[model samples]
Target: MRRKHLLNTFAAAALRIFMLLTLGVMMTLETKADISEEYPDFYTGAEGTNTKGINFVQSITVLAPEYCSSVMGDFTVVFKAPGMKYIKAFCWRQPTDKNPGKWGHDAVLADMELKEGEMGKFVVKGDEFPNGPMTIRIHAKDDKNKQDICELQLYNLGGVKWNQGIPDRDPPGAAGMARVFADDFDGPLSISPDGMNARYAAHKTGGGDFSGWQFSDPHGENQPFAQRDTFLRIHASKPLGTQGRSGILSSLRPDGTGVAVSIPSYFECRFVAQSAPGTWPAFWTLTKNTIGMDKNDPTFEKISKMGSDELDIVEAYGGYGHKNPNSGGVYSSVSHFWGQPKPDWNQRKLADGSENTDFKPSSFRTDTLQLGGKSSWSWTFHTYGLAITETDTIYYFDDIEIGRHPTGEVSKALPAWFLINYSIGGISGWQIDMERYGNKTDMWVDFVRVYSGCVQAPEVSASGFPGAKPAVVTMSASTRGAEIRYTLDGSEPSEKSTLYTSPVSVSQPCTIKVRGFGKNLKPSPVTEYILTTPPGVQGSIGINFVTDMADSEQALAPGDVTGIAPYIQGNWNNVLAGTKTTSRFSTSDGATSPVTLNIEGEAKPEKGEPWGFSGNDRRLKRGNLVSNPRFTLAGIPYAKYDVVVILGAGIHNVQGEIHLAEAESGNHIDAFSFDYGWNGGQHAIATTKPGEAAKNTNYIVFRNVTQKDITITMKWGSGKGWTGVAAIQIVPQKD
Candidate 1:
């Protein structure tokens, strides 16, 4: 990082922050296909204004997507620069670091001029770097300040050879890419006949040294990855030990992923530095273009030395405990390893004929970032990320950026495989430094999220009215040739999760979680839809509002028993303490005398018990309102339909009550009574219904709880003039 380029670079960086905040980007876990369509404009930078006459790179604006990790792909970046002659671009990880352009700060790498009159453009074709999010600093060759270039737009034509060898299903094969594969290494790793895997290693059949590492979950602990306290422990063996534990990519089959392996991909993972004298934790990727070497055999070293590309996102040095001296120091670097440096062919060999130190690309790191800004690596967990493509590669830490570079070297021009592991003694570094480190240590990883590939998850929407039960909802995806997978249990969807082939019928209030997947693309981010069906209700229920008749407005409407959005509806005014005298009328079948409430001698409330209705009688607040009749009927079709009335909370201290009703056939029905302590909630006053299922299960069933209907005149036997009320649920007893 240099001193002179601080203000200008950071200013541009500030603009990028603003863009990420306002733009809507697709935050994916597994991805493939077009990076631009999968995420947002943050991958290509902010759209610059038409303001021309610009020369310096400071005049350019960047608003790329928050993430873009296309390890191999072709895309075109279009820009308008009427007065621009030549363009030079530079990118360094640290905003404060000045060694930005790999070809110095004044080299012209991409030309932006064409004949007499034409807009300039930068084409990142298939022949580029490993993968994504390159922070480009472009300037005109003629002007010292790039002020002539105005607008910029990027259109990703999808990555080249994204997933080549995998057998594509016939007909509607893999129409969508739901989270088909992912492994937190939490529960026991499951190997099956269907070939679903999340953990892998090249040499040891995707399990590293076969037994060096183990997946552990003590039945008593509260974690799989419970923050710093508890997490998946990938413990390592002795130094120079054969095993290396890792996870992240799913294609490390011992059989090899032929040429054109994975599509342009985004790789990310969070890991705590190893704690021990002989521990080293790392997250890295390898280019698929390794033609001469075999990843598992001893001959790999010699072959890789000839020519190979590997990107080390993070490689912590050996460390012990949380101590600084034993840990991987205060910073980590993003290095690109491409064969040995010029004339360094013998660097891969050992004097004793035993494999020794291989050439370390420490001197050629694209960018280096200070860990926790001057903190030890093993002390905490940090995120390491890399987005690479054929033409450029970008690095990130904790979601923020490290820097980017052009595909200047040939090794960076190929697609790559991913890897995550805990190793002890390796090439140029970590040894069993027992003096400062502990003998046995473990790497605790929170979780790893790879944001590569693209899957336009389904967008859910509900249609029809709330009054209808078993609501009909549809799930659609914006990605072409995508299918939706969904669940109603509030759990995330995977390839094995329930597949949504058509409109869904939701019979209760539930959360509908869905994801979209395309043939070759990764699954889209999860989209949660909360669906609720308003209970079928009849006329409006009255309320006991404490407000005076003068101040309170229309709190109750005319209706025998109305219903809508919820189980009950009413206003407070109708239930005022002394607003209306307690009186009940007989059913229309026969003219029976009305009954008056026998007010108990000013009911005494327990000294400490607060009144259900709060506030003074003169004010119309929430506390001063109660449902009228202290109860109400809730159902529809107004005919002779059976149902059940389940007493809710409002009956705690209710006094005595009675009900006289006539059956629908004009015959006298059974009388009902309630003792002083027996009231609302936990009490079901069952009525006769047609056919019914087990009532023990949960569901807001409105049909089939009762068999017949009755009209009744119910009166309070004892209590103040006002009736205490809670909820009155009327579920249809007969479906």
Candidate 2:
């Protein structure tokens, strides 16, 4: 991978250091005794460093419904606590992780009149909570407000079977997508030598994360990771007092190669954690830039052309003190953009440097979501998910979308590998109190899964317009391994429809509907096209710039004037100049025009797979600063026609000028500048939602131009710019 620029790293690091250094001061102003008020024994920041002599309550022990027991129906909590005025019980439904401070109860307590002498029994129903791990808190307090709280850890198997492991249900908004990867941890997570067959690695390749202080491999004969009973447990502990050791499982292997999900993809993890003080647990993904890579590696070349990015699906910091409240019940979804142009939303700063503006760091952004209602993630296995499309990145908790942002440019450009880890207090200012839990904690992962974006809709094209002669129509799908199905009568195409193996001939005007299907994938959205001969002169041409030499070259199509629509490639940063092409452009009148096109100066071709677009629609030629590429179209039959120029750079945005002129006379026809805007870069395609037709101000029109040949020149806009042209069309204007 390309060596990360140190200037960007130091600039972002300086901001983080500033936050760390000022956290204490911020805490002083924002910290309140959110938990200490209920439990006087709960430690808060010391003011005098002296102990209070108040009377304290003794310990209580649960006698029935043992720890880790799976409860399905009604159950009684029988505990023992003598010399107490009254005892009360309530289910604090532990957060996905356990902490020492007081916790809130989700299930109501019963039989409040019961006394401790009678062995306190409070009836409760196991069905009151969702199926997952839970915690039952027993409280006993004296008149002096000093209280002793005890908790019982167990699982509630009310709605789900005990041995079923992680649920196999698909997440929301996953329609039409296909599962690309899945692991339930039913077997051991062993490391393979080359990381070819192994599903995981102990750490990221080449030694990154926590600076060697955490996620150590084989800590003194005790591996920090243990997989069994359909769950992968990551144990965190302070083995040497000052050093925090734990384990991490990455999709990347030791050789820096492993499973990665590309955009238009979804990744998710279902897990429970111990949200105790000082514990940090997370489910996240990073690009190859995070792993150690050699310049000669095959993938390194592709990665070198892109920037780095990180997607933190969930970051749960465990603590109940004033600085960290709600613990695992609340988590953050963060994204980092490294060594790339920052998105527009991340460009804000205090103009005068005198005011504190609500702005994220220049390199990162974060948003938090809470489970709410006294429920914490550590209390049970909750699914944390991330969906990445070309335009946006969405975060989901338990299948519910929590936050969304414009997809990072780097994220859209590169594939991402995932990681899960349990860390012991390092950077998350929340103080560690693991001594109460034996200086160790665990984060349980039930499963990790990945899904590719939906199969793109089938694109239909014709060799000639339907009229006096037969027109040969062809169809294609962008999703690999997908099968095209179609219908001639405009009916919805199903698996029972005619399977498309080759081009089909249409004798007359008719409607054709098509869809694509693949194994383990949701069916592609259905598309319908009407083929007919029109009086207006009509034709279109798409230019393909080679990025991957292995890609099959797409040929020029007749391109219907009635708008034949379907689907979506990005090339690297290099520019190609002086490319030429000559082709016969088919028209609606059943005649062909010999068109010769040539580009002068620098130009770039986009060939990467863009979501929701395919074939020639996915291709575009772009021009940049210093060289405005000019395309000369010769041999066009003399006629007064309206010329339409399609804009957009596939996944990238373009802001520049499109100038039309007579090729032979050198007389300018028209010229104007345009901007595709941020995030929503490709204006002609719906990169946010698959299969939806997105059309707006994505085309420029030069009306009633009388010319046998024309020249189109693309120049970068004044400020931030690149000029992208995907396709061009010519239609005769009515006299």
Candidate 3:
């Protein structure tokens, strides 16, 4: 029974082991199959197609690419949409380093719709991303529903990268800097045989070069054609002569059928003398009619009608120490206006202190300063330029503005062709170098650049309080050819704004907006100003007074008393008075009685004839009391006031003096004083006080009065002056 049981158990155990082995084998095969289906070998469209029918489904991936590190050129993505008239595709990118499957918001690529039955490929160019792993997603819409798909990998193969679809590298040989205009001339111009050829070659080569045009006697053999007034004269020796000529081999003359190029309204012309003992070279513009024609020709009427203007862009006289004559420097730029005769051009003083009074009709002269130690006349290639506009004319030299002339009154007849020449020998009439006659000196021409039109000034605005009549404002601008226009309304101004005939009027407060338009009709920034009306006032008055010697005593009174009795009794010395007594007298019925005192003595006049005592008692004798009393009333408003003064009239020398004080206690205010003789009179001197009410009740006083004067009289005494007494007072109106 035991043996049979053992056999069964063994059989059961074997069966279990076999079952376990089978299950293990199945699990291993399942895991291998799952990994193989989930992850396939990475391939980019650039490498080749993975499977034809099982399209890469670019719509299922990011817009750009993944693994674009090796991407070069453009990849054509082909896809199809069924039953749709039109289809559109958009591309996006996902970085493999972070959020490998998630796309970013910035669209790296996009494309318009593709027509039905049209099989198009979207190009995935290189440089879309830098060397890195990226996932490209594409969305395709076919009318109704949208289908999204993707590609696994793409790359930049040409060492280029793209971040957000922008190239990662700059183009080869790009320095990332701006180019500057060539303004400095340091080398010699490359010259050729022919004059025109030399100028053209120098311009092409772009340095400093010379054309074989001389400004000496053109009739001489081996010399170019002598074109009078058209050619510039270049001299190697000092003190340029009045008469210098040169030859210009140009078949075209200013009067001929040559093309008329408009002169710029603004430009700079600069010339440099290359030699240290520099030759003064002058570039002048002359009317064609002035050339080879007598000064008194009948046809000159037609010729003179062709007005010509010249600008002395620069002039360097050899006598001016090898430098420019005008500025006493190496470079000088000046402008000339010659439409009509003017003092600036025809009457200018030369370096020799002589005036150039003879009008050369249509001639403009400029020069180049000296440089280095050579005697060469080196011209700035394009240093000087001219501009002509409908409104004005401007000249420039070496990029610096020389001058400007308004064309408001002048006609706009364009100038003919220009000439460049150098002069050698001439008569010593204007002091030419006789020894250096016929010296070979060259005037180099680099290039001539002509521009047209004028630069206008900026615009300005007049803004202030609204509705206030008489509102004033000032407008300013910076420009060469602009006029100011303004409007009072808040509305913007067009060409129709009120033209600023003059400064704006501010009778009423208003907001005025202003704008400036250039010759090109372009408006500038608006400038603004605010204006307001002033306030007003009511009435006016003035005051005047006189002081005598007795008045001085009243002024020196000890206290602020209005009456003068106490001063006479206490200060008067026995030398001026034999006795002193008071009498009752009154100008008005007041609580106090008015009293007059009498004093007598030998009062003498000092040398300046009608002499009176110096009101400064401390500086005079007892018999001749030096009493001149002057007072400044403080805190007084200018108004009218009643004034009263009394003087004692008797037989002693007495004269009165009075003066008005300014608002402040100084000599800054004006003063007026008068002398009076003591003849019996009602008040010796009195008038309504001027300049408001006296804040400090102060008055001028006199010294030598000795008697009572109910009747006041003033007289001039040839002998000892008379005596006077009493008081002065002022009262305000009750109103």
Candidate 4:
């Protein structure tokens, strides 16, 4: 065993050296020639409508000699509509016999959106289109509703030939829970619902607008960027093309067949909530076959009872009325069987065949889950999932089990398809304040996944996978061939982010996050590996704590590192639990009112780094704090190199002075301070304002004047205040 371990270590060292030498070369590989030049007539025709007076399609060319049908994550869609703004394009495998209009049931090869006359270069991921006789549609719209489109050509990057090599994607979940259904809405919700019911019909309760909700924007903005996200927004608004309206999407296929799953499965979707008072967003499943039909008919009741099984995985309107308990964001789930009682046709029945009219206790029941904060559901993406088994049905928020129900007869009910709607003004008596909430509310969906067969997510065991070596952890792909992307700060991976070409090297105990990417495979779940350092692996020790729990940065003094406030008040507990964009690390101050400053991951250093902490948990972000922001720390020096601070945030054209001082002697050492004047000087990373639509705030590197071993304090401030500084690592370097 010892010999093998030594051999593994040496192998790892060799691999690392090899990769270091080859990485630069790999990054420099150029894209192959255009498919249009290589494969002529890939596209037979292209057209544009509603463009006022402009020709929408710039050009259409083919790359491979064949069509793209089942090929994705391995091809690129290239096009341009320079004459028009707001382009919405869809590329699909159009069959030789089926016309473009009949392309409904066929899979969408790609969904691309371009805003403000942008080029197609930013429209889609490289080589993501499938192989087949392709049909392309470009819906270009102006701010005033004028539309246009342009033909697209394929550009091959990575020299990926169809079927020449395998596709890279997230592995499917484990067996029994393996994925049975899935859609990122990469295109439109091609599947239609059974029929229009009361939910689809406009409700008078809050003057709701039915038919107002939409799928991917025909006007752009629905495009998820590779580095961030591309999602479909279910928007609720006061009539644009018409009047006050809400949105609804049925899961029934337009071909008349229902989309209900025939077996027990899980339905999961990541949604950005529209949590205002008047807005009601929900993810629910119903008996697709029986919906919009008469429940009073006995035959309908018996055979259709199979169709009336309804599961409300999430109803966001539950937070209304109960101000205290429901103060924070909350959702409700209910189970219902519309099989009416034998004699009482007006009442619904339970699994046991009983009828309860007044309380309707058995007819329908609800379970509520408080989401902790009022704004909890409004800002970020949270997953709501329904796990349906033969005997059990469960609801989840961000993967944590929230409510459960016996499968009873409902579990035995027919298959169900998901219906996502942004509703409003129902008669349920929830609060309605559209005037206060505004005329427009948006609900964004990242993806919807349905699974059965006891499938679990890909097992990401640091121990089990091959490439078994010290400091190297391999993630198990779901038996399906795929490539994985990873991050250290817990954010989900994006196509634009770094690709995991090989197992990562971890010198610190930071969290390494992994996610799979596959072309035709199911959605790959993000798996986090929380590495623990060996006792001997500890780096240089330094004090870490939160200086304040307020929204603003507090002044840092020599003794304020620990003694200034109790640890409890610092709200250090947040770092202990992590959930990607949420959770933070802090030093609490008990004397304070258990106050906390929230700093999501990426904004702070790994838990073990010396001086690794957000100063104000509530101030998890210091990039925008401008009023003399200061940070102080004292520790045994890690080395005698010059002081250099690595800062991660957005500071495009900002200038500031960073001050460094010796904490114990209160001495401003040699070459103590440097003024950060970006936009012209050498920049490590430059970006726009922080917390805005822009990414990263880009990391900034500053070389300090002094180098020493004594505990040090550093501060950055500008007359305009500060940009965001998510986290700072004091690395040893002079340049």
Query: Which candidate has the top score in TM-score?
Result: 2
What's the CA RMSD for each of the models? 24.8, 21.9, 42.1, 28.7
The CA lDDT at 289 in model 2 is 65
Report the lDDT of model 1 for residue 517: 68
- Candidate 2: where is the Cα deviation over 4 Å? 1-88, 92-105, 109-132, 138-151, 155-169, 187-197, 211-213, 216-220, 237-245, 290-294, 297-307, 322-328, 339-341, 350-374, 454-735
lDDT for each residue of candidate 4 in 553-609, tens digit (9 for 90 to 100): 322221112111111111122211122222122221111121122323223332111
- Candidate 1, which ten residues in sequence have the lowest lDDT sum? 21-30
TM-score between candidate 1 and the true structure: 0.30
Q: Sorted by TM-score, highest first, which candidate order results?
A: 2, 4, 1, 3
- Deviation (Å) of 642 in candidate 2: 79
Listed per model in order, the count of residue pairs whose N, CA or C atoms clash below 3 Å is: 91, 19, 122, 79
Candidate 1 Cα lDDT to native:
0.37
- Candidate 2 positional error at 542, Å: 56
Better of 1 and 3 by TM-score: 1
Per-residue lDDT of candidate 2, residues 56-153 (tens digit):
33346677876445677888877777665445554543333343222333444642433546677777777655455566655564333233445455
Report model 2's TM-score to 2 decimal places.
Answer: 0.46
Q: Could you tell which candidate, 1 or 3, scores higher by lDDT?
A: 1
Scored against the true structure, residue 299 in model 4 reaches a CA lDDT of 56
**Model 1: residues with Cα > 4 Å off, grouped in runs:** 1-182, 190-198, 202-230, 238-251, 256-263, 290-307, 319-328, 334-374, 408-413, 434-438, 453-735
Q: Please give the range of 10 consecutive residues that has the lowest summed lDDT in model 3.
A: 535-544
